[model samples]
Target: MKIPFSLPVIDADVIAEMHDTLTNTGWLTSGPKVQALEKELELFIGGGNALCVNSWTSGAMLVLRWFGVGPGDEVIIPSYTYSATALCVMNLGATPVMVDVKEDLTIDANKMRMAVTSKTKAVIPVDLGGYPCDYDAIKEVVNAPEIKELFISDNEKQEMLGRILILSDSAHSLGATYKGVPCGLVSDVTVFSFHSVKNITTGEGGGIVVNLPEPFDNAKELAFLRVLSLNGQNKSAFEKNQIGGWKYDIIDQGLKINMPDLCATVGLAQIRKYKNELLPDRKKIYNYYVDALSSYNWAIIPPFKEGSTESSYHLFLLRISDISEEQRDEMIRVISEKEVGVNVHYIPMPMLTLFKNKGYKMADYPVTYDLYKNEISLPVYNGLTEEKLHFVVDTVVAAYKTISGN
Candidate 1:
């Protein structure tokens, strides 16, 4: 038996909803189903307006572009994140300023505060492995009078925001919280990836939660992003079909990244169950891992909960003390040989060729490097059986022993 790192929840409701969508709904691409999903997510996020996009990259790009992030601008991001966090910045012709992370694997808010310059338009705090970054600290940094004074507004949105926009890279933390506030409402804006590997999925889709402050209407911003995702067309095909609605205007040169109704159906089914079922289930698995590994001398348990912040329990990131990167890799190899699959959360951004060529170095980010060198992400998904869980725990311990020659 093999255990994969992640799997999407596709239950009877998902299939039923998807079937109804394929046959019942007259539309497929970005219609009422997608609208329903947006509304549900909006409510799920507590107060923010949620916009469904084709992917996390597209949603993030749309938000960045809307904020006028372009040439000569810098978007600060943690080096310990998936490439999407940085790629979205590069796509907008803005520079992604690499920063080290805290032990929690979240961006260090103070480091970001120090990294700010006149060119700094945004600071993307990545909730890597579902653990939220220090939002209150970041809020203080962005809201400081001096920091606000340093902000150079390039557009109406920027001028309204008056400081660095906290666009959270929350791809792994949709249901997570920072100080009891949900991930969606924790930042100026939060983008959630509904990928196949995520806790909640829409096959390949994303949700952009808008929580921008006053003078910036979130509802209006939602409308703008919705149109922006639909190739700048103020009206969708469904709307165009209505009487005297054929006349539509191209607001701007926008992207075609709207989530389809077909995909939205799956997301809708998943989101409804997330709070009551999915999230809690993942938490159970997370607790079990911690309880099992706590007694071991070599086991360095990942930060699942630190103070008020709580994870979505997306990835069970386990670390081993006093191990080289080679030894860590060997552990994964040995574990996989036992048919227990595992993975590493990330290779720091500076270690990648794309950022390395841009003069960013891994040595510059000691904290990110320290965590990355020994981290191993274990499987945490729905339907992982008790026997499989036991097998996984045993397999990891056995692999560690093999690597250490113990």
Candidate 2:
């Protein structure tokens, strides 16, 4: 019953893929395998071209730079997300307008409307715990007449979109859907994480999907991103090593953030098993948690389905009713002593030191803090069995009862 909070699903097949890659290819950095991974991801997403990068943070930074989100610009983001979402904005010397989230733990569209000003360049709606944000609603808010009138275009990409950019921070949700539409097709641009703890893993990697509408060619953007991922070079090392290809040009000064072939090899192996094994197995664990915890009065389960939308079943954010933050901590401690693993989804940015120093106040975002105080992310991974799942639920319930003096 010693369950850890999460673990990567790296089997012998994945290892063999890496070994095969090393044996067959001498060029490891941003080579054919990276291109192949991007192609496979594009196909899996059903539309939109994909670009693989070393990490989601790097991908986000690339998107910001590509869109020309720099000094004096403001990028809106939810307070209840990982710091990377905001840090990426900061990296470009832009201001991050921290906003609140709704009960489902996604960014509140109404708050997004309130946060927008003439200087607002973009809004990054995070898919917390693998749940897709309400892109249609967010788009509507961004396209409102009042807001649209204030928009000042900064780059060619920004002018083509004709409004504020909806850059989705979909780090937790890869295979998720909204109204039967895949994540890659929901926003103007979407980013996915393949971190070790994410649903898919590349040891450490991420993907970017360009979904800008008609008049903006996604293929051209894909090519542009490939160049940007390397140091804005016209040719990758593999291409430069080819016959008479050594002569190349520097397009622009870009960051070095391309995904290496070694990591892409793991991504390829995981994706092959994704639709068949990884997704289904994770779904089973999620269902088990819901069924086991349904009878508990304090259990507030995470939302996996709402109308035609479905989560990728990334992390389970379970909330405890009427519990103090101290009591929640005590319960987690008790569960850990019993060898059942649990964790918090996030600590609101307003409560963190960096954001506090930036003049963000926790009191302003009551809903975000409320969600963070009582939420616990339970053990949900690839190989968790029914028996281990039961132990997890039972341990959590017992710990709560003990801590609450019920």
Candidate 3:
């Protein structure tokens, strides 16, 4: 009766696809199936060019590197997110200026504006726990004429600098929506994770979706950048096979982060089931959790902002109001003892040892810290049967009552 936080729901189709990929002719890397998955992701997530990568971390790093974010530049990110969100910025030798999160656990747009300075090159807003951030608010902050001018030396340079990019860490929100537009379309550049726990499964894969303004050929630029990111090779496995195209050039220094066709096959199967099949099942579990916990005054349910109907429902993050961090830990322990495994969504990035050693003060982000202290991620994947779902909910209620002395 052990219910884990999140588990990949795979079946015969996923196994069959993977087996077929293993038996297929092309298997080196980035073959026809990889390209096809990229195209399908682009179409599935609406208008944007999708580039498959080995991981979302690589996708974020590639996008930042392609956009000229480097040493002496600063990228603003929420303190309340997985380390990968900030690690990508650090990987480029750039600074990650941590910002606070609002009560809803998404980055606070106003704080993001205050964190901007001459060195600030981009703003990365994370869709924490599958909830879409206020994209319009973030865009307005990044697109402000005053903010744009601050990054450049003069009006002439301002025009040359281009608008500050909104690179979204949409790892948790592939199917999420904001104001009728999909989450992937909300930011200038969005990266989605297809890890075992994400809405879709690619074994271990991710994709980058870009939406840029004119004067920038994001698709072509990103395509070349993807090549550079993979190995700096002029041609991928698919391209090298073309008649007389075997020999290619190594254009720039790059990292090895290309998705194989075997992974893409799993992605293809998962993507097909995402819209019509898997999503509804997740939504059902989410509603059940909400309905079961509706009467608890201490429960602060995850927000599904108004006008946002297409959430991936990746994780159900429940915040225990007025609870200390120690109590939260104890509650998790109690739940685990009952065989209903629960976990925390994340610890604030600033609280991590690396950031703390680098002089990132956690007290600066009180709201973000508050959310981190109380947050608990409940089980909400496709594998949960109706009986197990109810058992998880009941265990949570029992744990809360025991911990709070209610």
Cα lDDT listed for each candidate: 0.90, 0.91, 0.84
Clashes of 1: 0
Q: Can you give the lDDT of residue 239 in candidate 3?
A: 79
Candidate 3 residue pairs in clash (backbone atoms < 3 Å): none
lDDT of 1 by residue, 1-406 (tens): 7888777888899999998898998788888999899888988878888889999999999999889899899999998999989999999999999888998888898888889999999999888889888888989999999999999988888888888999998999988888888889988899999998998899999999999889998889989988888889999988997788899999988999989898999999989988999889999998989999999999998877867778999999899999999999999999989878799989888998988888998888999999999999999998888888889999999999899989
Clashes of each: 0, 0, 0
Judge candidate 2 against the unseen true structure and give its global Cα lDDT, from 0 to 1.
0.91
lDDT per residue as tens, model 2, 311-366: 99999999999998998899999999998878998988888899899899999999
What is the alpha-carbon lDDT for the whole of candidate 3? 0.84
Among all windows of 10 consecutive residues in model 2, the one with the lowest summed lDDT is 24-33
Clashing pairs for model 2 are none
Give model 1's TM-score versus the native structure.
0.98
Judged by TM-score relative to the true structure, which candidate is superior, 1 or 3? Answer: 1
Instruction: List CA RMSD, all candidates.
Output: 1.1, 1.0, 2.1
> Which structure among the candidates has the greatest lDDT?
2
List candidate 2 stretches off by more than 4 Å.
none
Ranked candidates, highest TM-score first: 2, 1, 3
